[model samples]
Target: MSSFKPSMSEPKSPGSYCGVPAQRSSQWGPEMVLVKLEDCSHPLELNVIVKEEEEERGIKEEEEEERAFTEEQRAVTEEAEQRAFTEEQRAVTEEAKERAFTEEQRTFKEEAEERAFTEEQRAFTEEQRAFTEEQRAVTEEQRAFKEEAEERAFTAEQRAFTEEQRAFTEEAEERAFTEEQRAFTEEQRAFTEEAEERAFTEEAEERAFTEEQRAVTEEAEERAFTAEQRAFTEEQRAVTEEAEERAFTAEQRAFTEEQRAFTEEAEERAFSEEQRAFTEEQIAFTEEQRAFTEEAEERAFTAEQRAFIEEAEERAFTEEQRAFTEEQRAVTEEAEERAFTEEQRAFTEEAEERAFTEEQRAFTEEQRAFTEEAEERAFTEEQRAFTEEQRAFTEEQRAFTEEAEERAFTEEQRAVTEEAEERAFTAEQRAFTEEQRAFTEEAEERAFTEEQRAFTEEQRAFTEEAEERAFTAEQRAFTEEQRAFTAEL
Candidate 1:
């Protein structure tokens, strides 16, 4: 018989395992390369068949021996000793025959029991053999399965090791490529670092410039605010000063008015007292003249002539006193009217008041004519009256004192007094006009200065605002430039 053998170095091929005819007709797939047997027959049936064959052979041998023995015995003893033996056996009897038959039966029963026991032992042995063969086959199958599992595990391990080696080779190639580019990368990194440093420096400078611009703008704004505040304070001070000045001017005007009123009242009282004293002197003079006239009439028998002279002189003196009073009253009224007009002109914007001017001029002319007429009449009447009285009553009026003549108001003295008063009033009015003009000019100047200051402040504010806006725009543009530069880098 040919046996299948497998090699350890190489793998097996696809094939079949089968037994020869009359030996074992076993079949198996390609994987079962080892030799194997088929299942055995039932041992009980084989035991029954063996027992029958053994019994047949024993019977046949027993029959052949009995036949041979019967032939021989007949040839040798059938003619000689049969009668005497037969007579003796016959005399031996039936009890000995019975003992011999019992012995044979016991022997056959023992032999049959022994044969059954042997057959049972053989069946038990055959069953034990079959069980052992089945056990061996199972053990072999388990071993094969274990070996196949081991082969698969080894194959997986080899694949894993091969992948690890390939990965190591690829890493080595990558390291070589990286080494080749190291110089260029190092130079590029250095250049980038330098560029970053320069950009940082430029950005810092731009930031500082922006900060400086901001600081300057803030300083300018602060200065502008301070200047504006100062201007405001100055304006307030000027307004306050102007108010105080106006109050002072009003007080001065009130005081001047009060002084003028007092002066006018005193002058009027003095003038009235002077006129009364003059009238009393004239009366006394008249009484003296009448006494003188009566004496002449009594001494020389002069009758109606002396009486007529005394009455005529008295009438003339009375008329002269009345005219003087009238003239004084007219002068006082004219002066008062002129003073009122001048005051009104000072306090009003009446430069074009032509009617008032014309009226005042006409009134001044009328008063002047009246004053001249009164003065002429009074001078003429005084001269005439004085000449007649001195001539007619020279002897009697020789007692009149020279002091009275000196006390009398002549036309030249009155004219000189009026001229002095007029001059004083004109001078005072001129001073007031000059003062008013100065005050008005100063107020106008202050207003103009305030307007100019306001314009200057507005211009300065506009300039500062524009400067700040320009600086902010420049800062934004510079920042954009820096950002663009950084992006390029």
Candidate 2:
């Protein structure tokens, strides 16, 4: 029998085998077998006959025995592999358990250390509290001691001030007494000198009065002499008047003779013998008038001598009488002067005694006034000193109080500053905590973004590989179709 092989490039219809067209026939069963035949005279006759059932049954029995052997070998290999995987899994689980136990031990050690640190901080705080209490006690004791010392000092100063004030008052009183004594002595000396001057003036006035009385006596005597001289002068004036009348009568006679002579001479010029007679008559008249004047002068001189003798006699009489009167008046005046002298002596004695008594009284009054004024001055000085001391004490107390207030203010300010510093520290710690939280959140966001980007890149690479494989499969299908079409052509 001969076999035929189909060509790779043979064109076949759909659902056909080896270039043969398939048909449905009753003579060919569903299990039809393909046969190869040589060329023959009759188109349907076969040269070889074969039993299909017996050959197919032998081939099926051999294939079943080989498949059973292969299944047994595969089962042995699977069992071995499963045993190795179970052993490796047990080792990995044991390593993981050891690492978990180590982490738990380390956490417990950290917790123990934190507890120890907390206990040490609590002990330190307690020690600080005890120390603060001790310091406060010491400060309170110092304040009490200082106050007691200040009180002692103030008392000592007050005692010393009192003693000083007493000394000053005693000194002032002594000085005032000395001044009053000096003033009294000066007043007494001035009064004594004034009394002496007044006594001298009185003596001088008495001497002047005596001299005036003597002058009055002399004036009375001179007036009596003057009256007698006036009577003698009146008698001399009467004698002189009688002499003048006689001389006037003689001069009238001489003038009549001279007139007759002059008339005869005028007639004689007419007659020569009458002219010689007229010359003789003129000479005779002149001689007669000269004799009459001489006689009158002699009678007047005799009358003047007679009047002087009588007047002198009267004056002598008057002088004797005036002297006698003057002598009598002098005796009377002497008696009056003695009596006046006695009265003046009595008046001077009385005035001197009254003046002395008045001066003494005035001195006593002045001394009393001085004593009163001194006492008042002393009292005023004492009041002023007391007021000054009180003011000084008040000022010292005010200064001390101000100092204490300043110290208290300084302490309060220190406490306030410490509190502010603590607040600043707490704020700094809060800011640090917020910054740490922000950093942690930003790191987690960055990790998430990086993971998403990696996943997207892996997905893109897988999609590109799938598309390339599909394109290669389509190209292979196209090449096979082209070969078949060429063979058919």
Candidate 3:
């Protein structure tokens, strides 16, 4: 062989520490060759495989933690919903209590109105009775006055008759006893002259007495006539007074009825106004309750959605952390495999490097897929949670509106019923008033009939009296009746 020294351009040695081929070297030592050979066979490197396996385990644990966090989030959501339901129930209960109180108030007001109406009716009846009694008293006074007048007239007539009878008897006795019966005529001439003079004086006295008697009789007759005329005038006045009294009584009854009707109408209007106010209050309360319930439900929904979102975010964060960790582990694995490339003896490092690059690409692709899936899942869960919360809120609002409408309908029905009751009560009151008025009129008529019958009986007993006396008594009775009627008026 030609003394051959390996060229610097020759391929690198397999076991050289530097880039050189192996050579038989006596300058160093034979042991160095064995040591070098041993070193070459045993490759020492920073082992990264164990660390990669540990990183993978850590990633798995992180995923498990994320799952546990999601479970805890679900439990929290359930607790929130339960609390919201309890609050809603409490609001509903409070609204019901308010409605009951309003209803009780309405009932009390109606009862009070009815009591007042009854009191008014009682008062009216008492006034009517008082009026009737006053009429009776007036009639009695008139009758007493008439009877006294009639008695006085009768006595005067009797006295006049006696005086007339005595004058006739005295005239008859004088005429029967003649002047020739005189026994001793002292002087015929003197007796004749004295007798003549006495006769003339007697004649003059009789004429004067007759004139006085005529004047007395004329005066008595004129007094009786005047009395009869006064009685007639009193009778006419009494009749007019009675008519006026009746008219006044009728007017009073009419006015009372009108007032009662007005009162009833006013009461009905007040009742309606009260009912309307109550209905409005009830509606407001119901609406407020509905709004409160809806708000509570919305809050509950918002809370649940927030909890769900929080849980989702937590899960996403954990997944993102796991992906980051996995990426780091893959990069570390690739770096460690690259370091081993330089240590490998005679191995095709390019092939191994290519395989590692392919594995790294594969792992990167897997990590990308996992991250995308986690992001997509998180978005879907968020959308689903939001939709569910919206649906719950909408349902709550609808339920509240329906309940409010029903309450309003109930209130309207109550108002209608109250109005009907008021109308019926007014009608009853009017009917009762009419009946009382009729009773009063009937009583007055009975009193008048009794008075008339009494007068008739008295007249029958006084039939033997002079016509003038009877007329005077009748006139007096009539005048008394007029006075009573006028007093009543």
Which candidate has the highest lDDT of all? 3
Q: What is the lDDT of residue 320 in candidate 3?
A: 65
Ranking by TM-score: 3, 1, 2
Cand. 3 TM to true fold: 0.33
Task: State model 3's lDDT.
Answer: 0.51
Q: What is the C-alpha lDDT of each candidate?
A: 0.47, 0.45, 0.51
lDDT of 2 at 435: 48
Runs in model 2 lying further than 4 Å from the true structure: 1-400, 403-407, 410-414, 462-489
- Candidate 2: tens digits of C-alpha lDDT, residues 40-136: 2212211222234456457657755765675566557656755664565566466556645764675476457545644653564465446435544
Any residue pairs clashing in model 3, and if so which? 13-20, 13-21, 238-482
Cα lDDT, model 1, residue 165: 33
List the candidates' TM-scores in order: 0.22, 0.22, 0.33
1-489, model 3: which lDDT tens digit per residue? 011111222223344563233354454343222112224344221111112335545865785587568657755765675576567556656755775586578779856865674475456436544643553354345435433543453344334323433432355433432232132123334644764574466456535644653474365346434534644554464345435534666668567556656855786587568667756865675676567656656664665576467547645654664565456546655775675566556456755875776577568657656765665576567557656755764575456446535643544465466646544543554454455457556656755765676577457535634664666577567666654753452
For residues 1-489, write the lDDT of model 1, one tens digit per residue. 112232222112223222311211124333233322233221110000012335545765785587567656644553344454456445444534664475467447645754664475456446544643554464345435534543453344334323423433357544643553375357546745764574466456535644653474365346434534644554464345435545567668567556656855685576458557645755664465456445534532332344245335533543553464346445644765576578766745453464465466458647755754575476457545644643554443333322323332332234335434543544454455446556557656755775676577558657865875686577567656654753442
Worst 10 residues of 2 by lDDT: 39-48
